[model samples]
Target chain A: MRLAIMGAGAVGASVAELASAYGHEVTAIADSNSAAIDPNGLDTEAALATKRASGTVGDDSPESVLEAEYDVLVEATPTTLGDAEPGYSHTVSALERDRHVVLANKGPIAERYDEVRAHERNSEGRVSFDATVGGAIPVLTTIDDIGRSNVTAVRGVLNGTANFILSRMAAESLDYEHVLAEAQDLGVAEADPTFDVDGTDAALKCVILANVLFGGGYALSDAAVEGIREIPGAALQLAAEDGQTIRLIGEVVDEEIRVGPRLVPETGTLAVSGTQNIVQLQTERAGRLNISGRGAGGDETATAVLGDINRLL
Target chain B: MSERTDVRAHTVRLELDDEPGELLNALGPIAEHGGNLLSIFHERGNRTPRGRIPVEVDVEATPERFDRIVDALRQTGVNVVQAGAERYSEELTVLLIGHLIETDFSDTLSRFERCSSASVAEVSLTVADDATDASSARIRLAAHAGETDRALDTIREVATEKDITVISPLTGGDAV
Candidate 1:
């Protein structure tokens, strides 16, 4: 398949690197500033090397990347709330042009799922966003296997930054501020970590999952979101003494979506440590299916993006 | 016609009140929901504690159709005790030693039975003289191919909560 990749960040770069080996073409790639497009497939290695040397993917604007001819549009842009920006417009443009879309970006789908679906309905292209929620954990594809109607609930540790902090805090018996500082030093948390630590990231993922399982129109604001900043170290120790550990769990049942730190049995599946993500799908007939893997990282997210492209094939 | 590739064999156990049309009424949902009946085992002499007759049914249908069949059975007021695969290829025996009755042994068994990946094939209980004394149970569990470890982990979690000790073979297990 020919692909036009938006967002030349880690995910897009990794997708460009891996797409050809998987028998797919990366015809175009764009960063926030610039883009590179070629009708007969861009030189992925040269494009990536250029992006590393200079901070932009190429000279073409994001709009130009969307205008390029490709069978699938790989959206890997960073997520932003409200309008969900160039990503949303880019998706609408690609779909209107009768091209399928594979999203690694969560903004357009989470904030404006109904609008995206509306565009997909009229367009010849379909949309798949496996990397939006659980990175490379195959959460959405697993949902596809059993059918969405059979899923009763979706619970997971969606954000790696928050999970890393909480797991470290619980293990080292450190306070939130100390752990947050440590995470920042380790590049786990962003310099401005409000979106991750405040539960918005997890909430966004949960809202997207709720829309997928129960249909569209669920926004990040619809979820009951809470962060782990207020969870004291004493509470973690107390829970540990009781053979339980606290994890930042995001759960969606029916239309209700919530993200908060909950006590899970230490030996249980949800008590995953460090920067790992786990998604457990409770089905009406298939029982509980648990899948865990690296929730973040450029290459991992790109693997999911490529998997979605292959699924379209 | 070519055979459907997605079709799977499913078994459903039902408890029906002893009535003239109860047996016929119970089979209606299976047929109505696109299930092709393979066999039926109706125990006429044996009755459940509720005085309902126990019946076991084998049918072939796709997963979606099987879900519909189960729903139809419930809607028609048939007691569907179990509706899934009959044979779990992998088997393991675990022994739980503790206050079995106090920790709710029945609940433990129910949890193991509820897991779709595994099935509680058989259980044997050994009770001490007094109710206050500790007791033990040897549970034989069967799981779908390659799901025995997951099944064991679930049992371990339940055992940990009930303050029971679990003992099982680490290796030398095969599919039943």
Candidate 2:
């Protein structure tokens, strides 16, 4: 498959780097300001090096990459809320040309599912967003394998930054601020860290899961979210005394999406620690299924995008 | 025969005056109502705020007989704290984080008990050394079977009113 990637962020760059290994060609790649396009094939290493040294990928406008010839357009851009901007428009442009879209961006699919599906219904292109929900955890694909109707509920620790803080607080008896600062220093959490810690990141993932499980009509605003910011170290101590621990859990059950700090057994499957993620699917026939792994990072997320492209083939 | 088939386990919590014959007096109503005695957990040392001993009596009886047993106990002036069959078969544990001491923790527990569908079974509070800092409490609630959602909703409401953050147990999954 010839892939055109939008947004030269970590995930996008990693996708471009790993595309050839997965038997795919990078026809075009674009960052916010510049574009590197080649109808035949672009040098992945050269483009990435240019992005590293100079602040741009190439001299071409970012808009030109959308028009480049490609079999799959990987939307690996930064996630935005509400309008889900440039990403949504870029997705529509690809779908308008009947090009398949593999999304690493949660914005378009999380905020605008029905509209994207409506476009897909008219066009021959299909959309796959396995990378959006749980990085490389294959949460959406697992739901697909189990059959959407057969899966009753989906819950997990979808965000790494929140989980890191909570687990560190429990293990070392540290406060939220201390663990969060440590996480930022270790590069496990971003500098701002608002979205990941405030439950918005996990809520967006849950909203995306709700949209998948219930077949659209759910958005970020529809979710009831509470962050782990207010949880003091005393809470973790109380939980640990009872043989349980606190985790930032996102749940999509019975058409309701909720993300908040939840209690799970200390040794339970959902109690994954230190930036790890776990998704549990309640299947009607198969009982319960748990899938856990590194739920973020550029290379891990790029694998999901590549997997989606392989599926398109 | 049908009544025998319908018999189920029911628990009744009672506050009896710490006096001689109080245990025998509580047992009299169950025998009179055709309720077979399953067990009796008489906590002689544990007393309620009113200075009465707490007793947990388990009985096996039909729904009709259970209702009559409860009524007979109440009519006999026996203080029945809680009574139902399968009403609290499920337990939910949640962590409450915030100024628990400042917000009157006892009042919060009483409000939960007042819901009727749930009862505060156990609580462990951890207070910070700094008096004004936030405290945390682990509360175990016994809720009616299939009514965990209602119990959670009630908890959320009370917590919201008191400006507390609730870390609820993940439900609908056996792993947690």
Candidate 3:
């Protein structure tokens, strides 16, 4: 398979590395600033080395990568809300050119799923975005396997950073700021951390899951999102008095998608600690199916992206 | 296929004014909402603190039909005390030892009640001679089939937060 990856971040770079080792041709690779393109397949090792040393994949612009010959376009750009630009435009262009798309970017699929599906409808190439929701957990694929009609509800502890902070706060009886700082020091949280802490990340994942399940063209803005920012230590203490532990849970029931700190029995499957993610699917026939794993990492998420590429093959 | 194939039995408690035709009036709404009556316990001699007659009605209907029955009862001004008695197919027993009363035993019990797949079947609490001393509670929970582990997990979670020790039932396979 000939591949073009638009974002040279951790996920894109890792996919380029793994797919090359798997014998796929890396035809084009691009960063926000520059791009490297080769119709005969670029050298994956040389491109990564150049990115490490020169801070750009190559001097070729992003437009050139979109124009280059490729069988599939891997969208690994950073997520954004409105229009989901750059990533969205890149995806639209690839699908228009009759190339399959596998997304590691949550924004485009989450914000403009209807438009992406419309593009997939007109093109010969389809879109696969297993990494968009649950990292390596295969959530979307599991829903696919179960047949979407059997799935009643999809809920989970989707954000590892939020789960880490809440789990530490509950165990150590510490305040949010203290646990968040500890998480930051351990590199489990980004420095800014607003997206994870403010619940937008989990809400976006739930929105994507909702669209996949309901197919009613649900968008990120349609979700009822609440973060753990205002949760006080005293609330945890009070909940402990009632034998309940608070976890940041993202749930999608039909068209309603919500994300916030919810009181879940700590012994339940969703009460995972550290940087772990869990997805639970309520099915009409199979009862409740729970799947948990590492929700993020360059290589971990790239594993999902590569899996989508293999399915395409 | 019959509509009764997936029907479940649910019990609803009602508080009615001690009057002539109150029981008959309440039965009308249940039958009108397509519920088949299983049994009824109309205690006319008993009076609640509010001086109302206590009645328990058991009816069989699908979940959606049951919802409509409860709504119709409320809309018609029938004082519905409790909507439904949660039922489950399997049971598990666990002993919780700690400051059960101090940490709010009712709250702990309600946590079990809140789980959709599990319900508190019965509870027995024992307190030490000294009022301030520790206590223990034997809790029996009814859960849906194949969901005992999830129910036990909920109990374990609540016990952990309250600093209580739990002795759970033998849940076969991987005892360790």
| Per-residue alpha-carbon lDDT of candidate 1 for residues A20-139, written as tens digits (9 for 90 to 100) | 888999899988888899999899898888888997777888788888889999998889899998789989999999999999989999999999999999999999999998898999
TM-score of decoy 1: 0.64
Q: What is the lDDT of residue B96 in candidate 3?
A: 70
TM-score against native, each model: 0.64, 0.83, 0.67
Per-residue CA lDDT of model 3 for A1-313, tens digit only, reads: 9999989999999999998766688999999989999999898889889999999888899779999999999999999897998889989999999999999999998999999999999999889999988798999999999999999888888999999998888888877899989999999999999999989999999989998998848888898776876555544554455455677888888568888776665566777888899998889988888899999989989999988899997
- In candidate 2, what are the lDDT values of residues A157-274, reduced to their tens digit? 9999999999999999989899989999999989999999999999999999999999999989999998999888989998998899988999998899899998889998999999
lDDT of 1 by residue, B135-170 (tens): 656667777678788888888788878887564432
Candidate number with the higher TM-score (2 or 3): 2
- Positional deviation of residue B51's Cα in model 2 after best superposition, in angstroms: 35
Give Cα-based local distance difference scores for all models.
0.82, 0.89, 0.82
What lDDT score is found at residue A103 in candidate 2? 95
Error of 2 at A306 (Å): 0.6
First chain TM-score in every candidate?
0.97, 0.99, 0.97
Tell me the lDDT of model 1 at B78.
94
* Candidate 2 docking band: medium
Model 3: colliding residue pairs: none
Q: Is the docking of candidate 3 incorrect, acceptable, medium or high quality?
A: incorrect
Score residue A276 of candidate 2 by CA lDDT.
97
- Each candidate's interface RMSD (Å, one decimal) is 14.9, 1.5, 11.1
